[model samples]
Target: MKTVSFLTKKLGFGLIWLLLGLGLFSCEPDPIEIDLPAHEPKLVIATQVFPAKYMVVQVSKSFSSLAGDGKEMNADTTFLKTLAVEHALVQINFNGQTETLKHVRNGFYVSRNIPQHFQQRYTLTVRDSVSGLECTAATEMLAPVNFEKLEPEVKRTEKDTTVTLHFTLADPGPERNFFLISLVGANRKNLLPKNKIGSFNAVQEQIILVNHGAFTNGKYEGKERLTLETSDTLLVSLSNISEPYYNYLQLYQKSGSLMNQLTGEPINLPTNIQNGYGFFSAHNPTAQVFKISER
Candidate 1:
């Protein structure tokens, strides 16, 4: 009789646990619905003008982030082609003269006749015939600041050889100035005979930014050290850019990767284009090349 009582209690406890498990699994939360606001597409433009160089402008269209599948967007050639704004009228205005840019392939517009003048304001106007969207922006061409001197020191170690380039730049004046320093690597074999080093295909690049506040005594000095191989060639470029473009570059650099775009807060980059997105600016650049020794 006692054994029968024990079995009965055991079975009762088992039934109680089974019932609790079933009740827990049966409860399901209701689905949630969020009402997102409507999105409007805008025109996007990007260009940089240089003295004695042809002006080229690239135009495209922006789209809603939620319009496509929830995958990360890859800016491949095929995808970029779709975003290109075709049949657009692009023009540049300088000193009461307007030069219409000729459309090249894939939303690129070019004009070689419009000469870029330092400290002169140039206005860009872009009108898309298909979407009836127009945008205008103006920027002054900043003067090119050349490097005063570049002194390279080579340090050889058992593992590798590194070159340190010391550079100097004289401040134009007490007025505020912004500069961008770029260091890029290229293949020595890809250099065309009698061609400039800047024309070589760049493999990798690093950037250094300098603002007016960093200058002292009418001059600024900086250094960059890089480990180079035998087949590598380094190109150093200095660009004097406008303050607006400098702010734009700073915001762009702070924008995180695609994953951050999806999960974190969205960052709005600074743009000068009116009624559109993106930046239209002018800069002057001077570049020099450094060859690696085949030790």
Candidate 2:
């Protein structure tokens, strides 16, 4: 009698044939198809009306998220055509009086006789006849506030000297206020935020306010201190913005960087336009010139 092992030649051949048969019958899965709905465009308006100045309004249509890449490579001609709302009727209503704005070119509307009174409410109306879409928004201009222009305090050290400027004002009691401080003519490409201060630099050597930096009547009383390492002629503009404007800026200021968008949650900008996008705000700015010299 011959002894046979459990792994016999016939059984090994049978298992190999079974696997080959299964492999021959297997098929790759089909790709999934997704059908997205069409996107509707909304009106976008960016207008800032100030005292004793011509009202300028920029009208455009909001783009869909699924639209073509918003990048600007060989898209100069078509980009301009796509963003502008060329055939829209714009108007400004002030204290129950309406004035039609003239379309000067490329979706820019201008009005010479706009009421720019302080504490006055102005209404903006935009109508697209082809799409029968209309958008309206209201904003009130704040009265300009007075601030003290004091000399900068100089601090000397063994390595370098630091110049600090102080701006002080009596905050309007009981009412909330937003302030933006900026410096220009510094003649530097960048500014490093020193001592954990949230100061940001703009082109043309301007420094903007940061850190949800706001003041109320009780605490700061509209006092701001600016410190710089080098000395230059600084032109400062302190703007008193509305609450809605403040919220908008604060949101953007907090989450405006590309790093924040890449690593953190998405940020949606706050808009006050009814049936539209973008912000319509009125700000009162008081400008002063000063020289920051190191001692």
Per-candidate local distance difference test: 0.69, 0.60
Model 2 misses residue 75 by how many Å? 8.7
Stretches of candidate 2 above 4 Å error?
1-30, 70-81, 130-132, 150-170, 182-236, 254-267, 289-295
lDDT tens digits, residue span 119-222, model 2: 89988899987677779998887777556544456577899655556556556556556665556544223334453534442322343442223454333432
Tens-digit per-residue lDDT, 10-83, candidate 1: 67788997788778887655656989666555677778564566788988877554544323343345755777
Best candidate, TM-score-wise?
A: 1
Per-model TM values vs. the true structure: 0.72, 0.63
Window of ten residues with lowest summed lDDT in model 1? 1-10
Whole-model lDDT, candidate 1? 0.69
- Going through the candidates in the order shown, the clash numbers are 0, 0
lDDT score of residue 282 within candidate 2: 65
